[model samples]
Target: MRSKAAVRARCLSYTGCVGILVLSCFLISSCGNRRIVDHIKLIQSAGYDLDGKRVRSTILIGDYTEKEKTNIKILSTESVSSMDTMQRQNTKSNQSLHTGQMRLVLFGKQFAKQGIGSVLDRLFHDQFISSRLRLAVSGTNAAGLLSSTVNTHDTLFIMNMVEQNEEWGNLPKLNLQTSLYNYYGAGRDLFLPYLILEGGTVKIDGIALFKDDKFATNVDIRDAFVLKLLTENSRNGSILMPLKESDALPDDYILMRSIASKRTIQLVSQEPAPVILIKIKMKVSVREKPEYIRFETKEDISALERKLAAYLVKKAEDFISLCKSKQVDPIGLGDFMRSKSRGWNEKDFQASYPSLKAKIRIDLKIVQSSLSQ
Candidate 1:
């Protein structure tokens, strides 16, 4: 009954309405696609190991509830690729697997000994994984380490241990960025703290030495303490030395607190030998007073300083010997070479590392002592 022009206008209006509806629907669907699983399982820690030709990945999952408590779940898979393994895991779970909250990545002894470059490359290339996550080597099986329960003062005990270690300066802070940097460094060697489960408690055991993506050996906690003192400028810990005047000094241990340390390394071309000269200056506080010695004069202070210096120098020499024996460069010798020399190659440098002689000198100063008696 309407005119032809009016009918055409009405049809155009209807078409416009249809287009608007389609646009609204498209927007809603786009938003829906963006909505992944709401209750996603977040990985707190992960471990990697070699299982035949494939890599075995284990993830320690955790979730938070209204009560503010953590519930942990473990998921593991083996596949040719880490991504593939993750995808397979997603199929088995009702919620999506997320590594957004990942705190640590552990490598098994065998897996690390074999080679970790491929696995580490994959991690470095992943976008979802954070570069700030801490890296550690398991003292035992990586999978077992993650799965074992730890009891501590805090609810999330394992997480607390790592956080405290960083805050207290017990071990060198290792994150994904540090790991990648070490990977590309001149010696292609990296050292990570080893975590061991003992008496249902997790502890930072020692330093795990790595060479070109393979685990070379472990330096005990005592050795790690010396290594940290040598490399880092600031340290807050106790060291035990024998008392001066006691015939049976076995009962006496002087606890020295490191205040400051300066380390300098230089390469020398001496006759019939290639040598690296290391000079260390350290200031320490005497925390434990020995029962056998009376601190009455400057001469006593000088004697104590000399003794401490000798002890530190001996420890450093021992560490250098251990590194040569294991063929691992944890002191950043490669870095030293690369920084000092223009045309230094890692391959040639590593070959010469074992026989390379070292000259270490330690100058110690006693800043303060609580032992006045």
Candidate 2:
């Protein structure tokens, strides 16, 4: 009894209602894939070690059954590849192992030495893994260091150790994203925090130097500070300078803590290879100094600043020498040159890198003489 136009309108209305219902259904189904915390095991930290022909992976997961606190559970498995290690670990775990919350990944020294290109590649491709995830090199083997953290809240302890050092201590900032860029990108090599288990407690020992993807050597924390100064803008990094006999002072050493630092690199020449000049300008607080030194007068402050500047320039040069000897480019000098030069080739750079001439100039100012006061 309805008119033709009215019937057509009614049919369109029904179709529109059906479309809305279908969309709602689709959305609900998509969200149904949401996982509950209780049903999935979230991996907070993972470590990889090469065991002869296979790779061993150690994972730490938090058990949240306790009302007041979360306890850690350690799970380890050995397999041929990183993906297989995960699959094997899942077989052992009660719930599915998820790396969505992973905060740290460590490679054993031996494993890192052999090469970590494949592992780094896998981490880069993983959708759930965060770019901020911290990476490091273990002192010996990852399993040993991880086992030492059984009772303690190992995950947060190690994560905070590396993060605190990078922010306030001597370490330079390095994470998953930076490591990937340095490894995959040309003209630079990657470095990572070197962690060693000392006296049954985990401690950050130094910075692990790398050539391409392989671990080349380790530099102590002091040298690491020099590297940090040259590579990036730094703050709150402290170092000790042992005075030479020629410099007459009551004390034998000066402890300089960086308040802020800036580094500038310039390509001076390129015809006979590259001649690079690095200028490091720093504002530092003298935490420890000779008692005989006086900071009350402008002349006294200026003299002390000159001595500190000379010391830092010498240290920076020594660091550059070591890197050149090792054939490593952690400072990305090559990368800088590549940007400036018209036809910079990696092969040509490597051939001429060992004897590359670099000049370091330091402009250090003593903003605070706490020891003098």
Candidate 3:
């Protein structure tokens, strides 16, 4: 038989084991959350430019905690690669560089043309970095993009502009994670916002389409809206589209506020000639109308809807043809084909992609007029 003292000792040992396990877990969790925020140099936004075999990186660090004051600093360096450039940038920075607060990462046109796989691969592997980080291609010098005068020290000014546009304006939904998904995922390519410096101010130039990981070309911001409608799930945006003279409206210009758009793509055939049927149902508002066109009748409104649908059909068809010619599947037509077919190969898909027939049908309506929602 065990003595009473032996039982107490065993109970104390079990309690000690439980306490040790609880303490270990607390230490592990505390280590995971450990951060010296004040000591870390949080890069707010950064840009990459390629010069020959070298890379130029520009980082923006901003502190705007003080009332009506912002401390802004711009650091740039050229190196063999983006990771190396970051290493060099750390030396130039007053504090240890960290990407915990990164909002935007811009790649210059030349850098994008060369390829962004290495830089992006490194960033993607960095588990500490944000998956929702915005990525853009700069039409101007990447380093020069942030050299302009700014009102706020927080890099939020430039980043907020793009974010707000994607949220409420014409830009599509895109970020580091989505871009990478399209890049690595089969049957679909990637698209990113293109930024250009205009008169010392940065503006969203268009949408940059990628043939794999390399930059292909750009779709104009206006056309980007159409692409967004066709490819993405978005419900709000405005397009100041120009309508030529029609039986209903003799004017050549009109404003369209997009309310909703739904697209249906079907791959009907794979042999002889590949054929895909596309249909888009879109609702828009007439924000501007010319006095030259008298809209006194319901028939007139119907005519306007038909005219707008026709115009959009022509534009969207042209855009799709352009993407086909460039060998880019930004709309994931190949993905749609894969979903429909039993077995598909990349070689067959590539060979048959450009020749694929795209038949479009647009059902459009003017839902609102004169800011009446």
Candidate 4:
């Protein structure tokens, strides 16, 4: 038999060996569990297109290891859903597809018009997908637009285009969070930036208005700009109001710069139908004008401001008329009424919606003249 000291030492050695074995096993298990980012394909942008019973999904994956590379690998597949497409794509690809880097998700026009309830639900349920991803509606097929060689890589290209516009362009800041709210919230709807392929280039065509999840109609960028001004507290955009070409004028238009704008929507009365009043105050400057107009004279300035006010009132009325005709409210009129009135619900709002009358008042403040036409 061994001495007591020797026996103790032997027991310690055995315990040490066991500990080392356990540590090694734990490390190997952890290594297998964690995903290696470098090995996986990072999806930067993706588009969803629907063709009857099938869904066509296209994604842009860039080689992260490659520096300054423009061309990206495009992976596309047709399946029942976006998640199904991903599973199928993974089978075809050696690298696992990752969506942590996805910034934009676009829907083809047809897909949008068909309604995106089920698709959006799937996306919301996806644990790996970011809900903050920007949304847009493509005037053309989303897959075709993503596959086009307009830019070496359309992911970064499209992201930059949309981001820059949100900053300086005439668009309200809209993302997945706001979109979800609009969709689920009563008396509200979602509007996404509209994109189209123009002359071998992708361009912002207009705004796609959605009544619930289904596409209602599209307003070109010009009208959308005005809509934003009316809804948002302050915005920047330019509108060229045509001054009829006459013998005295060298140019036939007055380019008005939108320095700032303020709008107030009031629920005036519920008599007969909901009577709403919209008050718009605009601060503008003359960016360009016909040579015939005199900027130095106060009378002339007042006349120009009046002209702007009158034009805007008519424009606003026309916009509201269009909304009524389409039976779609992109202006959030329902929400406004709901907030102000008691006992207002979907049924009540629907009854009053058809005969909803609106009065628009516009006050234009001309600030400065950029140049003498």
Clash statistics: count for each candidate:
0, 0, 0, 0
Decoy 3 TM-score against native: 0.88
Candidate 3 Cα outliers beyond 4 Å, as residue runs: 1-26, 29-34, 64-68, 245-251, 371-373
Question: How well is each residue in 1-373 modelled by candidate 3, as lDDT tens digits?
Answer: 9999999999999999999999999888887545688777788889899888889999888765677887878899988877688789988977788887898888999999988888889889988789989999989778888766344555756678788888778888888898888888788998999889898788987799999889999988887887887887677777765655445433668888888888888777777887888888888988776766556689988998898888888888999999999999988888888888878777788888889888888899888556431
Error of 4 at 323 (Å): 1.5
Q: Which stretches of model 1 miss by more than 4 angstroms? A: 1-38, 50-55, 79-83, 150-156, 242-250, 270-272, 369-373
Candidate 1 residue-wise lDDT, 1-373, digit = tens: 8999999999999999999999999988887435354567776778887777677888776655536566666788888855576787787677877766777788878778778787678778888888887788887777777777522212244555665664564565567888788887776468888888787656788889887788988887767767776565645645677654567456577778777677887888633546888887788888776676656799998998888888778877999898888888777876776777778788877778877888888888888656345
Which parts of model 2 are misplaced by more than 4 Å? 1-32, 245-251, 369-372
- lDDT for model 1, please: 0.74
Better of 1 and 4 by lDDT: 4
> lDDT values of the candidates?
0.74, 0.88, 0.83, 0.80
Highest-scoring model, TM-score = 2
TM-score of each: 0.82, 0.90, 0.88, 0.85
- lDDT top scorer: 2
For 1-373, candidate 4 gives per-residue lDDT tens digits of 8999999999999999999999999988887556678788888888889888688888888764557755678888899765577787787788888878788888999899988887677767778777778889999899877777436655567777776776667676677777777777788777888999998778888789888789888888777677777677766777777676355344777888778888898878877788999998889888776666777789988999999888878777888788778777777888898898788897778667779998888889999755433
Model 4, CA-based lDDT: 0.80
Candidate structures ordered by lDDT, highest first: 2, 3, 4, 1
lDDT of 4 at 327: 71
Q: Which residue pairs come into collision in candidate 2?
A: none
Q: What residue pairs clash in candidate 3, if any at all?
A: none
What are the C-alpha RMSDs, in order, of all predicted structures? 7.5, 4.0, 3.8, 6.5
